[model samples]
Target: MKNQQLQSKGYLMISSTQTIRIISINETFDPQGVKIVYGQGTFSHYSKDGLVEDSIAYRAKGAAAVSVAEAGVNASGVAIGYLDIEVKDSDKGYKNKICTLVIRSFIPTTTANTTFVPTTSAPISPPASEENSKQLVNPVPTVAASNGYVNTTDSSNIPF
Candidate 1:
């Protein structure tokens, strides 16, 4: 079936195998007053070289944001596995999204989930590469003096 038809029926699927190391979750309100739990973290995907750095600000805010927040808190160093992008009906509009992170079976081990270190062989040159793909991944590390957090991604890639 076509993706659009599938989406209309309340299914959003990402065909990639991905992983996310959640750094932080914050509760905020949208202008429309909906509770938005913003999650920012590092992302990696299985490549021929094993897990390679993919993006940052792996924001998953919406229906599953609450769960993401909870997991981050209770599961110290929680690593969300088998992550996928899903879209369902929402007040916002058709195909409103919630990044769905699933647990296949066993719980994640502590070491893998705690920290996110970029494994990109080269530094990310932003606004060019990211813009072409229309997805914002934290290509560079933020200065420590600025904020304690790793870094939030640019606004370009968030599909909402």
Candidate 2:
């Protein structure tokens, strides 16, 4: 904290306040084929007036590092911990640049084949599941019940 010496009667001067906001963030899961037991992290907002190391035009590009110190369960049911994320400013003082978050997929080479065949049989066919579509059981028929259907029952037959 910087302080200015008080003159005559002791008093403070030049009080300033700053506000920060998160522009964009890219966060993804990293599964190492293990189960994560716990998860904890932190993020930061970047601005010229904040505690950023460097900034300009009241805006700065920065990132907040986060870690899953304890670990937790992920979508793949793998034990993951020590998660890390960086808090970064999007503007970076460039007016023409558009800010966006990106998540990259990690692909492994030397992949192994899961299924085996005699080179004559075709690959397994995907079975139709409920997620693919909803089964219509005893469906109620309608001439035009749903929305966006225009009724053309003629002017004379039309009931007022």
Candidate number with greatest TM-score: 1
Candidate 2 per-residue lDDT over residues 1-160, each given as its tens digit: 1123242346544332222122222334346433221122122345778854321121111111121111111111111112122335567763453222211111122112234656577788776886986677866545446555666666987678
| lDDT of candidate 1 over 78-134, digit per residue (tens) | 434344555677766567655544432223334323666878587767675555676
Q: Cα miss at 93, model 1 (Å)? A: 32
lDDT of 1 at 101: 47
TM-score of each: 0.32, 0.14
Worst 10 residues of 1 by lDDT: 103-112
Q: In model 1, what lDDT does residue 152 have?
A: 67
